[model samples]
Target chain A: MGNRVIKMSTLYLTEQGSILHKTQRRLVIIKNKKIIQEIPIFKIDRILIFGNIQISTQALSFILDSGIICSFFSSQGKFKGSLRPVESGNVFLRIAQYERYLDKEFRVEISKTIVYAKINNEIKFLENYSKTNFKEIIEELKKNINNLKDKNSISSIMGIEGHSTSLYFKGLSLILKNKFLFEKREYHPPKDPANALLSFGYSLITNEIFSLLSGIGFDPYIGFFHELTYNRPSLALDIVEEFRTPVVDKMIVTLINKNIIKEEDFQREENSIYLNNIAKKAFLTHYEKRIQNYREIIKVQCHKLMDSVLNKKIYEPYLED
Target chain B: MGNRVIKMSTLYLTEQGSILHKTQRRLVIIKNKKIIQEIPIFKIDRILIFGNIQISTQALSFILDSGIICSFFSSQGKFKGSLRPVESGNVFLRIAQYERYLDKEFRVEISKTIVYAKINNEIKFLENYSKTNFKEIIEELKKNINNLKDKNSISSIMGIEGHSTSLYFKGLSLILKNKFLFEKREYHPPKDPANALLSFGYSLITNEIFSLLSGIGFDPYIGFFHELTYNRPSLALDIVEEFRTPVVDKMIVTLINKNIIKEEDFQREENSIYLNNIAKKAFLTHYEKRIQNYREIIKVQCHKLMDSVLNKKIYEPYLED
Candidate 1:
């Protein structure tokens, strides 16, 4: 909103048993009392800490109080949570947001816009894989989008979304050469490598949107499209629907089809699959690249939502051309 | 709301340049690489870190994720901020709270209740010190309470509160053996030892209420009596009003009258006064004792507030008998 461009340097602390220490103005990564890496604190925009990493309270408090976004993830890449600094001083915007959420008509209308954009992005993403014939699946997705227009309640919209997602995943399987590893979409414990990638990518993007929305002073817990779940950033989830295909999904396709990520890159544990450390690094590289490219589009979509809530403007979701 | 009582063991880290390290199930406090103190993590309910104390991220995250409240303070005992865990999953309660805040009549009614309780407690506290004649000031406070019944807005209510507080502190000066040091009330940089104690005590109690209210799922930012300011926990401040006299002021009187804290205990820095390390340790001991004694009363007061918000019950403030 201020037209100030922030250069994002996301520092990932993936090494287990490493300590993040503060030395003067730099963050030093120490392992077994040896300094492994060091970076100036000012250059870092955000920190993504993986499992079992230790950071000094001085460093933790410094980063938090400095207003840097710090998020935590499990070793397997599940989003644990983030340490948010004291909230912004914008109570009026939150009140406006609550008013919109309270209004059923406005809620339904915004949900429709979000669902429409999500399905539209899905179709465009599938269509980009020119080798695959997603004609039947695209028709089904379009039908689901049309079905969304008549859906009144959030549950019904979610029903249509669920149906479209299943079909979209079916379409995705058709496009990937490594289709055997991804027969269907399994969420909780992604049974296969592709599902694992999807879940991880979604978690990363959702965390991004959560930080962005909070920075913009919106209550990310309340949402129109997503149900108000306990401790979930529902509004961020809602906004992230539009970005799934353009940001994460498209990148997932490239990772698989380009052989950028190999089958062996995944490791299986008790029926759940996850990217190995090397594969996660590769995945993050592409993920960060995709995010950089689409960051402006993401900000614009967030602004559109703010306008919808604060100015009674019709919410327009981001759809890839 | 749960009848399960939490035994509060507030672990205060007062040693400057100390590191809080996690050793299996225990927290080890190390100063100059020497173990100064060790406590079982389970035995600790909350941690208060003061000035230059470094904590390992492992310990900080473990404490926070385990729902233990951790607060930070300056070396001179100024409340910096706290690290709160993820919020409770009670969106509906917050919505109800916002609706009440929006209703001008309900807001005004609740503010009156809170202010009435606060002034009543102040009078009772002053009355408790029999060595002083605060009868005229008590009468003036009663007048202020009566004046509150007719006030329709927060600002005018604050006006009454201001006048009553002046009279109350004037009464406080009469009760204190060391009256020359504290002739009047000063807030921002408490000019004298009495003001410093008051500010520090209020901060500790206010933080306690903030954590309690948040744990009960109330948005601590919104309030009835206090004007919504940026990053200030207004609702906590509002609730803390009823606590100021009973919890903080009474303790201040004891500290002064009993010579538990000496005049020389305070350190002066360019017109501002603060409690030194030894005096702070003494103050925290008594503060914790008072909190333990009044914990049930505090919880009941919180429940009364919850009932008022959720059930539209007439909000009754906690008045000292």
Candidate 2:
């Protein structure tokens, strides 16, 4: 007997349509005379609508009740605003989340853990390629991991994280067998397909962690490792740091190397590169498969954080075995 | 551009397993060393577990928050009970639902609507098969539809519903092209594959409507047409009547006639016929496809009901044109 769970799917409403009024708890998608897709709001974590899509107020209410986020983006792949549930989260967790910021020792400890895990996962990923050229970066990552352990300042930890990511991507670029270019992790309107994928994948994972943390009663905007900035979900970024290499980076690399995603998967407009409809679907399918592999990894780490805040258990970051 | 929705899937934990605690807002399904399924709790409507499956306290709490239902049934295919969110539903809607039952005129009005819709949909169904052979049943259905309009008692409406169902199934049996037999609509351990599928399909639709009605703030146990009894979701039953012919019955008949479901798809143990794993999967796939056609139909009717209670809008039962 196996424990079976219902897999929740991300509803990508990329078509130029509008969401009709919800009837019987089902969200209706009408395209002209035909009802394109009818999804139950309960099974959705986020609604990522691209291009000219309109969501009714009723649909948004159900999305909020289901504790999912609705993100709207421009057709040219520019990031827009997201609709989130009203911030009526647990005050106790919120207080604890903010309190950790004032505790310099606590902040350093968590920041060090995130940097260590990120660097460690990068080393593990490069090792999987069996390329001798990556030995330099791997050694560099190892040294950074040790450096991160003694770091007492959040600034120094973030500086090391930035350095390690640069080295990791340089090493990753060498292993990408295809013509898909990855040039230094450019994010805002990515110039290449590879960067576009990395940016898209990161947003997907970040939003996922944001919803999970919020559902667990934490304020998504507060953070200890990452500074709470204007309109930024800093807590999500803090938690997403350790997961970058293993989840999003690895998935994007695999998609490129396996040639499952290609140059044609992108739409070129002026200086920007965006994922075409086919590529978005392919990337999502592959990401879902990849995410399942690390689902426990993400859950376990978050639960440990909750345990630390509520039950006084020590927060342990996810480190590759 | 078309509308898109997230499809809610039913999770059947029939493997005598237990649901682990919720982590990261996603339920962990552990069976031995393997993690079977990790689903977001909000994305699930009902967890149908058959025989010896256990759920943890934490998982139940998440289920309650998401306004979903978890049902348990015997391995012998008998429904045991459902763990619905504690009856903390809107007092206003529940009061309206209960008040309608006390008003005999109100009760008859709603009952007549349900019967009229059920009979009208059946006539529409038979007309799809042939114009010649079903003329008599069509006329009978028309007579029942007219008779239903003037009915003042719940008992007489129930009688008409019963008679119309008999005639509908009789017409259906005539149209079924396969060797698979459909002697009568049987439940409590269906005797044949067709009957088993019909019963199973009906249950799935009924449970769906139950959750939908409950989600819309209606108490599932209260009803107008069907009498509220111990352990019965009478309101769900009352609403399901209008949908049975179009959604469930058509799906079962199509599956059998198209030979998509075979006799081998069932397992016979003494006198009971049960759907085998493969057949169950095929049935669900087709059921989902079939239900999508009427997704709007169900939603529209439920919305009408909600409006009737909240805004005094005339409750319109679904009448197929």
Candidate 3:
């Protein structure tokens, strides 16, 4: 199953009032009774529907029957929910996962591997992009990575991870060419344009990992690093930490430094900053490209996690070069 | 949360060539270019759409947004799948559930309690309606009920439960007024009319419990007595054991004995017997009535399970008086 490679295409329905209709094997997007786009449904792998788009029940059923995942998001790209096929029928893997989650030593071992890889990736990213300007901060992050060996509890590892992330983001703030004021990492409605871009990129990557994990038959709610939180996909969160610096943070830094996205491109509403439509299109294009390059790595990481859970293999986190 | 009672209504779209449309706050069902039914959307608690029914994307979104579960079924009432809102935000409860599932002693304790109540309810049902004709079977079931106390493992308890159920069904066969021949329990396409009714009723009740458990934030895929099976909601299956005799089994007995569902009302296709449309309607009506009466008991049992998980309280199953 892991070796089989399939070309995947994602259809995004971002138009507010467009309706999705089905015609035989094709999906037609219509806005105000005007045909805007048509694609063969077989060629599409998944769909991301943004705010207020209507779909005909036939099309909805067809998508579901075809086992295509459809995710719903607010116009601002806040993930509302998703509709996926019945989860993979692999209860034994989940049982193995539950057993591992119950074992404190196993949880600590896996959590440390994840946190170590995350900080390593952060240091690599910093060295590649902003080494001269942020040398002390980068060395501080490297020290924290080494310090992870002595951390015996998940919360203590989290404490080191939190401090390292703050330093990494502070280093990132220095690398911006567009004078984007990013003092610290703020989210749940990111405050600054840099933070907003980071948050959006993280969301996209997190959703990708979430779908991948579900398809691989792991209970995405259970995790080793992230403590259990209500409605939070903790396992997905744990996996995404490894990808954060390599995927989202790197792309976000490039987007800001290359002037591909400007400060004015983001709009502020009620103390939250988000990319406007045009900027979102630019960001998504780059985001998709970066994700396409890393898709295999993400899949491999997931399979490794499965190996750790099921075969009791020592969990190894993905380290960026 | 359990104490808040709300009126619920289910809309079943069984017609093969119908379309569902949304207008403002109402849902209109159209067939053959005519409006067949129009219902206020707010009045619907859930929807069950049978084969080939088309629902507008607008209506589907409205249903999802309203937090109403929509389940799909085959024309012959086979359980297909469902669309539900984002699951409740309660990860702590799930963690507690996982911890309990991982404890061998707790698993056995809960499993024994569930199986014991299930058999006791079966005995009560048999004694209520078929006491004189099947006295030996009832006595045998009674003996197995006592045997449950000595059962130390979930599989052993399941052994007793399975034997008692077979004996209970044998007793049920003798009491049928109509010439419905149900020699044993058969499923995955019930082979006879009696098994068809039983399977259909169980499917409905199981779906109800599945939704109930999900709404209450339990991972319905995990279980105690029922070993985890691929793609199976083992937890829901465990809870439904207690309801089988009191709800579905009793309804099937009444439907068969009262001659409400004649043998002629069932149609055989390939190797499976299924209720025809009219008979399905009659059976569903009675099934809904029976479910309405036991709804509170089922909810209470779920809450008790929650208490057992969260508080480590003694888990008790609901037994018929």
Whole-model Cα lDDT of every candidate shown, in order: 0.82, 0.71, 0.82
lDDT of 2 at B30: 73
True contacts kept of each: 0.38, 0.00, 0.43
The residue-by-residue lDDT of candidate 3 on A211-314, one tens digit each, is: 77877887787888898877788899999999998888888878888889998898889989878888888888787778778888888999999999999999
Give me the candidate number with maximum DockQ.
1
DockQ of 3: 0.45
| Reference-based TM-score of each model | 0.92, 0.48, 0.89
After superposing candidate 2 on the true structure, give the runs of residues whose Cα lies further than 4 Å from its correct spot.
Answer: A1-6, A18-21, A65-67, A76-79, B1-321
lDDT of 3 at A272: 92
The positional error of residue B75 in candidate 2, measured at the CA in angstroms, is: 46
Off by over 4 Å in 1: A1-7, A32-36, B1-7, B32-34, B131-133
| Comparison by TM-score, 1 against 2, better one | 1
* Angstrom error at residue B43, model 1: 3.5
Best by TM-score: 1
How many clashing pairs per prediction, in order? Answer: 0, 5, 1
Enumerate the candidates' DockQ scores in order.
0.48, 0.01, 0.45
Q: How do the residues B31-101 of candidate 2 rate in per-residue lDDT, one tens digit apiece?
A: 77477767776666567655555454346545655656665555434454454442233535544554555
Q: How well is each residue in B1-321 modelled by candidate 1, as lDDT tens digits?
A: 111123556677888888888878878899998998878777776788877888777776677667777777777776655665655657777788888888999988888888899899988887776753677888899999999999999788889988988888899888877653788889888888898899999988887888788778777888878888777788899899998888888898899989999899988899888898888988987888788878778888888888999999997778789
